[model samples]
Target: MSTATATPEGALPHRDLSHTPWRVLVLGATSGIAEATARIWAREGANIFLVARNADRINAVAADLRVRGAAYVETAVADLDDIDGHTALLGRAITALGGLDVAYLAVGILGEQPRAEQDTTHALHILHTNLTAPVSLLTWLSNYCVNQGFGTLAVLSSVAGERGRKSNYVYGASKAGLTAFLGGLRNRVDREGVHVLTIKPGPVRTSMTTGMKGSEKFADPDKVAREIARAIDKKQDVLYTPFQWRPIMAVIRAIPERIFKKLNL
Candidate 1:
């Protein structure tokens, strides 16, 4: 894609990709939330470049999106944990899409707390996948968007990140790290004509959470995707799926440490 030669003179021009036929890069493209969002984008006729560890699944998703009205659909198979390949993969995505209008990073893994506590390697692996690798990708994309002068960087975070819970503190910590990273990155990149949206959603019905029991409060991935699309259009800083999650997390965060520690989350 052709880009302007010089930086804009003042505040960035307003641009929204939600309903337009724009270019989008969906990292972790085969994941439930990512795939759901892809469908929404497809219905709006966006051109999509998808990257995920599962080649077969991504190929199927790409095909399905074509039928859903996507102007173009392309797929690449790779694990986000392989940080060494991030620069090249992102480069390929930008080239394939002409310009990346939005990049949704939905790559993460949940770890068993008992196993993580007992094995150093297990905890590190979760940290690597959930936090380290994503930071690398976001850093690279940040610079690109800054130079190109427009892009939306939306990363999937979790409400668990708001506070450490005994049930899933290990996974929660990784998410907390992600949440902090996005917060700082957003502040750094906002003025660069980039909108960094930190998407914090409560549990959603997905294969990843299939083993999670008693998910009465869980939501549908499609519904969460719709809210995400809305956030992108509005260039929201932090988005809580279901909207109710915003106040819920706020209450969770406001609890004093002394009182918070005394009660089970």
Candidate 2:
């Protein structure tokens, strides 16, 4: 049985979350980019529900958001990879928030490329967390939003997904799949008044890219978060953070396979 709230059909487009006191749900609330984005919403006095696997980290995040001026902050500790629990978890979140306005999905992993190449288990783990789990959550969320006729689904994909490079093809593939999924989901739900945003960010100064080469050149998370906040208000369909990544990925995609495979990415 579905637990989603129902509303009158043919409602108008959702009001932008830029309005103060938005009811928001942040999955993977402990991630650097996610936490930074939540902080922006917090300053607007948004009501938030945080979900993540780490109890200590999630609790700290909730506390910080409250201090940052969020009107309300609630949290639940749960591993999002457990697809079986998504429905119940989302139900609780919606209840806590009084209703749903925006859901930011910032859950993903960058598995060791060499290890993934040798171990199917490692590769599958990456795919499961980055792809399958998100699909499950989106399926439930999209339906709920469709029934109510309003919501924004902002998801984190990666510029790496634009074209696969030998360096981290496994992670790239997962993001590529997610990007495609978001595209199709937008096509299906846009007419129903649900906005689906695919956020393709280049490497940012986050824990995920902490030890990587050229880490000093990565984009700042705070700046990226600001763009994201604006994009949601504008209801953009796709966002390339740092903006330069849009052209950079275009060039990479335009390269022919014969010449591309020879050059290191």
Candidate 3:
């Protein structure tokens, strides 16, 4: 599969997108939340570049976006965990889209916690995919946006990161590290005119949570996507989707570690 797509000749390098379609790059284009958010952007006639490891699925997403009224749609197949290829992939995305207005990162894994507890390799794999890979992508993206003095970096983190629960502490650790990285990235780039939005979602319904207990009770991914789109438009620094996770996580964070460790989460 081709790692990148072609851009039209004479595509504008960069411009104020307020009057034109927003150019967007979605890292985990096949993820439920990212795809849903892209659909909203498509309805606004955005130019979009989708990057994901799955060719068939990403192509379907691109076709859907095109039919939904995206001004331009392109897809590149890539395994985001392969950090060495990120620079090249990101370069291709920018070249294809002409410029990037928003980059949404939704790549992550909810690994088996039981296996992670007993196996160092499994735990490290989760950390690498969820934490290390995103950090690498954001590092490059932040520098690019800083140089341009414009762009939005919206990342999908989880409220589970607020406090470590015995059930999924490994996954939570990955998100916690990501949340910290975004916070620091925002502190560095906001003054340079770059917006870094840290999205903390509380168990939304998606492929990752398909078989989990109480999946029906999970927040709708579409609703979460709408909130995310609004947050980016407003240049909000942090968002807790469903509007309840903010206070929920706040209470969770405020619980004393002494008492928190004793209760089942």
Candidate 4:
């Protein structure tokens, strides 16, 4: 009953979409990195479905993509936190696209550590948003991809997930869960010809971190977007934005637990 495509190249970078126009769905389309990626896809004349909570924001993004020479652009506004809506939302996305070639999930939140530590409610919301919701959506999408047999799935995890830091362990724990999920999902689906990419971005200068200082190490979303496009074209398994975060996190994870805990992150 699977309608999966037997394409060896997967949805992305298996072939150039410059002329063929692959269909792409961008979840959390309003995020800075997602917005930048959508623009890159637009330049290749890809058809895109933008999903986000804000209708007006998604509309503006759609207009920009249309103007950028996207073959087709549409919007589906919904808060990604609503796990119950994922099935209907993804169903609508694939239906609008006619079929799905690639889906980029770029939804998450940076909850306040202080608040999370003080209140179980705050902690649970962060966990649900970053871990539970994405898991639910990815499970659905993975099944769809398996049955369809052709697609690329990329998710935005965080380098903070590499190892839990005291400052943002709640956020870190969520991403850590997501990262593990992606790894398992990738193993299960790759043989079926689906590309599952786990993207870990370090500090990013965006609306979420606007007021936070110490952004000197933050990667530019535009630059990060371009790199992501290249990685997709190559059908990569894991990508660390700006290419430097990999080693940075590697060293951090390599430290002994006793030593790591003693040092301030």
Please identify model 3 stretches exceeding 4 Å from their true place: 1-15
lDDT at position 203, candidate 1: 88
Error at 23, model 2, angstroms: 0.6
Runs in model 4 lying further than 4 Å from the true structure: 1-19
Q: Give the higher-lDDT candidate: 1 or 2.
A: 2
lDDT tens per residue, model 3, 79-125: 99898888788988988887788999999999999999999999999
Candidate 2's residue-wise lDDT over 1-265, tens digit each? 3433433234434565455579899999999999999999999999999999999999999999999999999999999988878888898898888788999999999999999999999999999999999988898899889887889999999998888889999999999999999999999999989999999999999999999899999999999999998999899999999999999889899999999999888
lDDT of 4 by residue, 112-168 (tens): 999999999999999998898888878888877776676789999999899998999
TM-score for each of the candidates: 0.91, 0.94, 0.94, 0.92
- Candidate 4 RMSD computed on C-alpha atoms after optimal superposition onto the true structure: 4.1
Q: How far is candidate 3 from the true structure (C-alpha RMSD, Å)?
A: 3.7
Give the alpha-carbon lDDT of every model.
0.86, 0.91, 0.90, 0.86
Q: Name the better of 2 and 4 by TM-score.
A: 2
Candidate order by TM-score, highest to lowest? 2, 3, 4, 1
